[model samples]
Target: MKTRKLTAADAEAYWELRLLALQDHPDAFSTSYEDAIKQEDPIGRVKGNLESPDAETYGIFKEGKIAGNATLRYETPVKLRHRADLVGVYLAPEIRGKGYGKMLITKMFQAARGRDGIEKINLAVADTNPAARHVYEQAGFKPFGVEEKALKMGDTYISEIHMTLVLEDDK
Candidate 1:
C-alpha cells in the first residue's frame, strides 16, 4: 500500500471513495450519503478542500485505488491554532482488520507534527465501533470525554467517544 496527501487532481477518486464510505457505514460519519449526494458541486468542493492550507487529507492506496482516507484539520482561530481535529476517518471494509487504519492514523500524526503550532490532535469515534476505538487507542489517543447521543439514525441513537493525542515536539 502507498500513502500520500491528496491534491485537487484527486478530487474525483476521493469523492467516489467518500460516497462509498458513507454508504457502507452510515453510522461512522456525521454526513449522510443522501445529504452528501444532494450537495451542489461536490467535486468542486472536494477539490477546493484538497487545496486548502488549513487541512491535509491523507489517502492509502492499494492496487492504485484509494483504500482509506483520514483528514487532519487545523483550527483557524488564533487561540485554537495549536489544536487539530482528525476527521472523516474511514477504511474500506475489505481492508479493515489488516492494520491499515493504524497506518493511516500514523500518517495523520506525521502531518500534524509537521505543522508549526499543532500540539494535539482530536477525533471522535462512534461508541458502537469497537474496532475503530481500539485502533485509536493503539495509536496513543486517550479518551477525554463522550458526547451522548451524538448522532441519530432512524430510531437509533449513537454516542461518540472523544479522543486526543498530544504531540511531543521532539517526536
Candidate 2:
C-alpha cells in the first residue's frame, strides 16, 4: 500500500472512496451518502479542498486505487491558529485490521508537526466504535469529553468522543 496527500488529479478517486466511506459506514461519518451525492460539483469541491492552503486530504492506495483516506485541516482564526482538526477518517473494511488506520493517523500527525504553529490536533469518533476509539487512544489522544447524541442516523443516535493530542513543547 502507498500513502500520500491527494492532488487535484486524484479527486475522482478520492470522491469515489469518500462516497464508499459514507455508504459503507453510515454511522461512522457525519455526512450521509445521500447528502454527499447531492452536493454541487463534488469533484471540484474535492479538488479545491485538496489544494487549499489550510488543509490537506491524504489517501492510501491499494493496487493503485484509493482504499482509505483522512483529512487534516488547520484552524484559521488567530486565536485558534495553534490547533488543527482531523475529520473524514475512513478505511475500507477489508483493510481495517491491517494497521492502515494507525499509519494514516501517524501521517496526519507528521504533517501537523511540519506546520509552523500547530500545537494540538483534535478529532471526534463515535463512542460506539470501541475499535476506532482504541486506535485513537493508542495513538496518544486523550478523551476531553463526550458530546451526547452527537449524530442522528434515522431513529438511532450515536454519541461522539472528543479527543485531542498536544504536541511536545519545545518552546
Candidate 3:
C-alpha cells in the first residue's frame, strides 16, 4: 500500500471513497449521504480543502485505488496553534484489520509532528465503536471527555469520545 497527502488531482478518487464511507457507516460520520450528494461541485470542494492552509487530507492506496483516508486540520488562532484535529477517518470494510487504519493514523501523527507549533492531536470517535476507539487508544491517544448525544442520525443518537495525543514530548 502507498500513502500520500491528497491533492486536486486526487479529488475524484477521494470523493468516491468518502461517499462510500458515508453510505456504509452513516452513524460513524456527521455528514449524511443525502447532504453530501447535494453539494455542488463537490470534487472542487474536496480539492480546495486539500489545498487549504491549516489542513491536509491523506489517502492510502491499494492497487492504484484509494482504500482509506484521514484528515488533519490545525487551528488558525494564535492561542490554538498548538492544537490540531484528526477527522474523517475511514477504511474500506474489505481492507480493515490489515493495519491500514493504524498506518493512516501513524502518517497523520508524523505529519503533525513535522509542523511547527503543533503540540497536540485531537480526535472524536463514536462511543459505540469500540474497535475504532481501541485503535486510537493503542496509538497513544488519551480520552479527555465524552460528548453525550454528539451525533443525531434519524431517531438514533450517538455519543462521541474525545481523545488527545500530546506531541510536545515527542517533538
Candidate 4:
C-alpha cells in the first residue's frame, strides 16, 4: 500500500470513495449520502477544498486505487487558528483490520505537525463505531466529550464522541 497527500487532481477518486463511505456506513458519518449527492458542483467543491491551504487530505492506495482517506482541516478564525479538525475519515471495507486506518491517521498527524501553530487535532467518531474509536485511541487521541443525537437517520439517533490529540512540538 502507498500513502500520500491528495491534490486537486485526485478529487474525483476522493469524492467517489467518500460517497461509498457514506452509503456503506450511514451511521458512521454525519452527512447522509442523499444529502451529499444533492450538493451542486460537488466535485468542483471537493477540488477547491483539495487545493486549499487550510486543509490537507491524505489517501492510502492499494494497487494504485485509493482505498482510504482522511483530512486535517485547520481552523480559520484568528483565535482558533492553532487548532485543526480531523474529518472525512474513511477506509474501504476490504482494507480495514489491516492497520491502514491508523496509518492514514498518522499521516494526518504528520501533516498537522508540519504546519506551524497547529497544537491540537480534533475529531468526532460515532458511538456505534468502536473500531474507529479504537484506532483513534491507539493514535493517542483522548475523549473530550460526547454529543448526543449528533446524527439522525430515519428514527434512529447516533451520538458522537469528540476526541483531541495535542501535538508535542518537535523542537
Q: lDDT of each structure?
A: 0.94, 0.91, 0.92, 0.93
Cα lDDT tens digits for candidate 2, 82-156: 999999998988889889999998888889999999999999999878898998888889999999999999889
Q: Which stretches of candidate 3 lie over 4 Å from their true place?
A: 169-171
lDDT computed for candidate 2 = 0.91
Q: Model 2, 146: alpha-carbon shift in Å?
A: 0.4
lDDT of 2 at 151: 98
Instruction: State residue 102's C-alpha deviation in candidate 1, in Å.
Output: 1.0
- Residue-wise C-alpha lDDT for candidate 4, range 1-171, written one tens digit per residue: 999999999999999999999999899987899999999999999999999998999999999999999989999999999999999899999999999998898788889989989999899999999999999999899999999999988899999999998887322
- lDDT minimum window of 10 residues, candidate 3: 162-171
Question: Which residue pairs overlap in candidate 4's backbone?
Answer: none
lDDT of 1 by residue, 1-171 (tens): 999999999999999999999998899899999999999999999999999999999999999999999999999999999999999999998899999998899889889889999999999999999999999999889999999999999999999999988888324
- Number of the predicted model whose lDDT against the real structure is largest: 1
Per-residue lDDT of 115 in model 3: 89
| Model 3 / residue 18 / CA error / Å | 0.6
**Ranking of predictions according to lDDT:** 1, 4, 3, 2
lDDT at residue 159 of model 3 (Cα atoms)? 97
List ranges where model 2 is wrong by over 4 Å: 169-171
